[model samples]
Target: MHRLPPYRLRRSARAKYLRLLIRPEGIEVVAPDGLPESTVLAFVRQHSGWAQAKLAELQARLAKLRQGQAERFPAEGGSVPLEGRETPLFIEETGGSRIRVSLEDRGLRLILPRACGAERDRYVRDALFGWMKRRLPGRVAECVQRHGPQHGLYPRQLRIKSMRTRWGSCGPANDVNLNWLLGLAPPSVLEYVVVHELCHIRHRNHSRDFWELVSAHLPDWRQERQWLKTHGGGLIQRFDPVFP
Candidate 1:
């Protein structure tokens, strides 16, 4: 018999069924307060396959983090990947009070007040996120409009959010919700996610028919999917504070 790996077990007073959390720290097993240790062990054993897979995934993520796969906080001379390329970031202090950002031939340029103080990091993050908010909506709308019609799949609405666990989701009402962080990925990758959710409008489940619809629209979707699987975590982690 295969033995389960070492994990920390905890008893919750709220009294719920067994819940397992695989995090960067480690695996945690949460069970009802009165549940027998043997039962908890049995539960872990029952889900050993899933637990092992999740552990491997998390370990890979941690390894990527250690390798610095993405830039958390970009400085004046630093560069960030934008639209499939490593775009340089140029930060300059201007005498004006307002902060301005623009895309140049080499990369992105930001102009901030010379007297900008402790709030610089927040200002930069906000400026970048605001720029993405303004830009991504139109891009997503264009993708949906362009591809949705071809497949006879139309979504009633489109929403952008900072999703933690998913790139995008399609609701039963034909609403497509996309992760704003996708703007950091290559254009093809973003398009794949949009097409994926749009296909869900036709088939809500991940059945064979659903994937067939996706491939019909985006034949290179598997490559894009692999790109996200390899790079998505770094993009999602970009929101974490680098200074603090």
Candidate 2:
């Protein structure tokens, strides 16, 4: 553990509605409409303890996320899940940088380059993204078609992007966005998420109406949602890991 360092707080007006931001750079006080400088300073002084704790929590979470990224896929003798079974990862010395994956009774064997390192990580990440892009649209469309008919909700377009905090989003006038990370989850969980977003086409918010719509398609939505929140982070490993 590192010792806590003394911090110099600065007042900044760039924050939209957040009251305080305690980034590693420094503390930034978001100037709310009509809030006096003295009041904001006083608030900062009183809540210094809370800010430090929040910073500590963020640091710990970052460490955990990084650890997860490093171990996302299996290394030599490492194990990952296929369907519900445990499988071992075997690395072979392939001539080039390409990864060739094969699943067998021994689990999954991933052929790696003799010089595997950061470059190899990037290759795996790109491969995962490509697989997701190719497969997600049809699954998303299936969920949309099954549920959209009931509410006269039809989507104009469907796209996949890496999102920081959102699972999926429903834009105005029936545009839908899904997180590419959906590929890492199980088929049932992925289907649940797709249906959840499609329901938003009819009802935009997480209000009762929106939930009712989701429930109509997936009666066990709450279970799936909980699974995503608890285990979803496990699926969040990247070969070329990036964090914000």
Candidate 3:
């Protein structure tokens, strides 16, 4: 008889019988009543090596993900990838209580309060992101006023969300939600995103009507869209905003 990989078995009253499920995490075994001890032991004996190999693969992938997360931010005197090159961040102590981030002398400058410590990195990151969050609503409102009337589309409500995967989203109810991270992109990209969401007010899906609406307000919207798509990973990766 052909051998199968070793797997754990869990008893569930709701289960009809023995079941197998394969997932990215691993394979699972479920039995309604119970599996015989001899059968379980035999299964393990038959494919112990395969099980061990699968377990090792999963652990390696997890280790890589954890390592990537830690290395997301560069160390002092180290550089982080920005645009197409590695850009260095110059940290300085300033008298101001609030932290500020600005581009200076071909490098990114982070001016932190004099009271800074190990916690200062998270604090400054939040401070800069908070500024973006605070300004997003007004920027959306302005975009609505400028483009809404022209397209005969208006948002019932505008909101900001800390979404992980999108620049903005529109609802069937005409509500608009913009990703707080959009503020990190260049100004034109932000405008393109705003217009994109407002266009959803008229067309919910990415249909011809939607593209037409987006083009009507922003003729060069496609270029900006491409720029953001290619460069957006840097925006979220740059801050690694610590959520409280």
lDDT of each: 0.83, 0.68, 0.71
Give the Å shift of residue 99 in candidate 1: 2.9
lDDT of 3 by residue, 200-220 (tens): 877778998889888889999
Candidates sorted by TM-score, descending order? 1, 2, 3
What would the per-residue lDDT of candidate 1 be over residues 1-244, giving only the tens digit for each residue? 9878888988899968999989777788999999999999999999878987998899998998855634666666777677667789898887879788888898899888888787776677767777777779999988978897796888888887767789999888988888877887899999999999998888879999999999999998999999999988877666434445
Model 1 residue 201 CA deviation (Å) reads 0.8
Q: Where does model 1 exceed 4 Å of error? A: 1-70, 94-97, 113-116, 239-244
| Candidate 3 local distance difference test against the native | 0.71
State TM-scores per candidate: 0.64, 0.59, 0.55
Ranking by lDDT: 1, 3, 2
User: Highest lDDT: which candidate?
Assistant: 1
